[model samples]
Target: MTIAWASFTPWLALSGGVLIGLSATLLWLGMGRIAGISGIAGSLFSLKAASGDRAWRWLFLIGLIAGAFIVHLLTGGLFEVRSGYPIWLLVGGALLVGIGTRMGSGCTSGHGVCGLARLSMRGLVATLTFMGTAFVTVFVIRHLLGFGGSA
Candidate 1:
């Protein structure tokens, strides 16, 4: 198997991972809540949460969007990512993720990061399933279907 050496950015990826982990840790330490995007987004629709809970949830959600904006500003431009899929396909995939997040108890950041760190058995299973599924998906799309990009 050949490696995509030109596309590899291990340093950048590791730095991003560190930043995410640190933010999650700080959120947990300061607010006693998991920094799970799905939960934060879903909590916005809850009308009966306690005042403090609602406030922090909203803050977290806003912070998430704002953080990305700030990063774009610092970087002087938005990064361009080349995905071969059309907008409709991207939206469809996002909708499917919403459903999966609802069914699976949390999204990747929630289960794969925070939950796994806490040593939850469910988190272990979810992470393994997700990683395995992702590997199979790339293999099928690239090798079997032969639709992967040139780069």
Candidate 2:
């Protein structure tokens, strides 16, 4: 309900958004591929994927990890892992996300960024569903369940 004024970084957030958009656009333009991380990663090791396809997927995944590492190093550990949440909870959440992505036929990056950019109706519906679910979940956790604190 309230903003975390101390942690607010609008400029950084805007910059990050721009970078994501730029990278997605570039990937589309250059390779004629959608920058759907989940799809790319999910098919990376599949027998259906060609050897050349696997190489790009590996590079993309590696670039994601490397980018985060580079930022962490540059900021001297600006990002810190939050404690308090149990490992099982985190793992469960990840598994649920993976399942959800599979069930939905694509992840947020695929449906939201690429699909929406192409003016696809499916993308709009998927994005709305994703956002609506997220809002409800946060509301339940913070207000009804009294789990997460106002951050």
Candidate 3:
């Protein structure tokens, strides 16, 4: 039950959380849209999406990548490429996440942040389900199977 003290960065984590919250709030207030990455990305290429809608989605997605790149550049490569996982496992996990997001109707940003902010019951259920599943998965991987270490 030891904390990963060396990896802990509370202030940076808090700043990131605040930035996420602020960005989500701004997107909601300015455009009346939930800042859900899955929803934005999923519908980006849909035939039913309007040209304007697609434009914004593209810009949003670009901004996300650009933001991370800018931070990496500014920090002189503070971020590192993750290693140690098989390509098959990574792809499988990504596929599962995509499927889960579709089944859940939203992601953490939508359900946990915006939905909860609006006091929606569905959001609470979705967030709880997501957290519960994550907890069990991590426990099983790290304790039971003993394969999750800094990966």
Clashes of each: 0, 0, 0
For model 2, residues 6-125, the per-residue Cα lDDT tens digits are 999899999988999998988989998899988998887446888878988899899999998998889898666777775765787789888888778778899998889899998899
Per-residue lDDT of 131 in model 1: 85
Q: List the residue pairs that clash in candidate 2.
A: none
What are the models' TM-scores?
A: 0.82, 0.88, 0.90
Q: What are the lDDT scores of the predictions, listed in order?
A: 0.82, 0.85, 0.87
Off by over 4 Å in 1: 46-51, 81-84, 141-151
Q: Which consecutive 10 residues in model 1 have the weakest lDDT in total?
A: 142-151
Report the C-alpha lDDT of model 1 over 34-133, residue by residue, as the tens digit: 8788877776764666777787777777888899889888999746767676675568767977787878878788999999889989988998997898
lDDT of 3 by residue, 1-151 (tens): 7889998999999999999999998898999989998888888745788887898888989999999899988989866678887776678878998989877888999899888989999999999999999899888877888774743
User: Cα RMSDs of all predictions?
Assistant: 2.5, 2.0, 1.8
lDDT of 1 at 23: 89
Candidate 1: clashing pairs of residues? none
The number of clashing residue pairs in model 2 is 0
Candidate 2, position 36, lDDT = 91
Model 3: how far residue 97 lies from native, Å: 0.7
Query: Which stretches in model 3 have alpha-carbon errors above 4 Å?
Result: none
Candidate closest to the true structure, highest lDDT: 3
